[model samples]
Target: MPLNFAHRGSLTEAPENTLPAFQKAIEHGAKAIELDVQLTKDNHLVVSHDHKFTRFNKNVTGLIKDYTWDEVRQIDVGSAFSEEFAGTNLPTLEDVLDICPHHLFLNIEIKNIPVIYDGIEQRLLDTLSHYNRTENVIVSSFDHVALKNVQNINPDIDLGMLFYYRMLNPWDYAANSGLAIRSLHPNQVYVNQTFVQESKRHGYEVYPFTVNDVNRYAELVDFGVDGVFSNEPGVFGS
Candidate 1:
């Protein structure tokens, strides 16, 4: 079956990236949970979609990389969205990993292209090594170097390439990189059945981004792609 991933959890119904949102997505029957990651001040991996935490309490300041996890935990992330999510603190990658269900796959995007996570790849590998989900996780990023770094650390895990927009030949990029792309994500206009077929021909899967409007989703489904990243994974098929 073609997979459906919730972009930043079921962001349509809950605060993006919070535990509540993730849990909501899982309950909604999403097969995969997609989220973004940034480095904390103390080198811990933080599960946040943005480079900074502007949506949180105004007391929180500075780049996310500049603050320790302890400091980050104090900030409230859900309040900006509404009182319902007022106490939502940013979750660490480990925090998220612990809560994720065994049946669903994970899609983690390394934010900030070219920013090295230092030992983050090994950290991720070490964490997954203990879990029964070695084959179920997929790491993705627009940062070719970052994805390549993760691949260098653990080749057993699958990796995908993410593109907010498309190029004439994304397959060439993946092919030249010496990694098998389990998935390729491109902008709507950049995608066509030809690229989808061509990517599949090269042994890669295609899953585009932010596709709303039922007709467009239907068309994308017709094009032979494997999945989609949508703001409302729960409502898509309903």
Candidate 2:
């Protein structure tokens, strides 16, 4: 059976990237949780889908990079999702790590494409190292350079490359591109039997993202994906 990763911690149930969302994923019996990470002005790693909080909250608007950890912590990231989630503040990367179960895999996607976080790779690795949970995590990014940095610093860590558009023979590209990534996370719309076959042949796993429809998820599973990132992990297995 393919692993079911809750995208942004069951985004359909709770605020994306918030502690409550992650907790909800756990409740739904997700085998893995996929979340985005970005650096604050104080260099603290925070859990959020976008570089700015405006998407999550209208009242709290600003680039996460422009705020320090203290300022970022004060933003109500959950109220916009629902009033029940009011006063739900942003979660620090450490806070999320502290709650994740040992058996669950964590895909930490570095949000570096829009904003360059100079030393984020080192800090992320260091934090994971501190918790002694690097083995349970996969560091992924759209930023190939950031992924390379992760590999250079800690070759043992699993690295995944995330891309939205369709790429011809992506498995081959990842295997031979000298980046040495272990997995490919493509948009679910582009995934098909040929892609899965190529990925399996190349010894790279394929995990597509944001697949919420039950029929589509089943189609991808039938195509032989190693796993899928879904907003509704419960539909797959919970």
Q: What TM-score would every model get versus the actual structure?
A: 0.93, 0.97
Which digits, one per residue and each the tens of the lDDT, describe model 1 over residues 1-238? 6786888888877789888888888888888888888888787778887777775666667778888999888888898888988888888888887888887778888786545567666666676777766778888888877777778887777898887765768888888888767888887666888989998998898888877766787888899989888886643333
Clash pairs (backbone) in predicted model 1? none
Per-structure clash totals for the candidates: 0, 0
lDDT of each: 0.80, 0.87
lDDT (10s digit) by residue, model 2, range 48-78: 8798878877776669999999998888887
Error of 1 at 147 (Å): 1.4
Off by over 4 Å in 2: 236-238
Model 1 residue 144 distance off true place after TM-score fit, in angstroms? 0.9
Q: For candidate 1, which ten residues in a row score worst on lDDT? A: 229-238
Of candidate 2, the 10-residue stretch with the lowest lDDT total is: 229-238
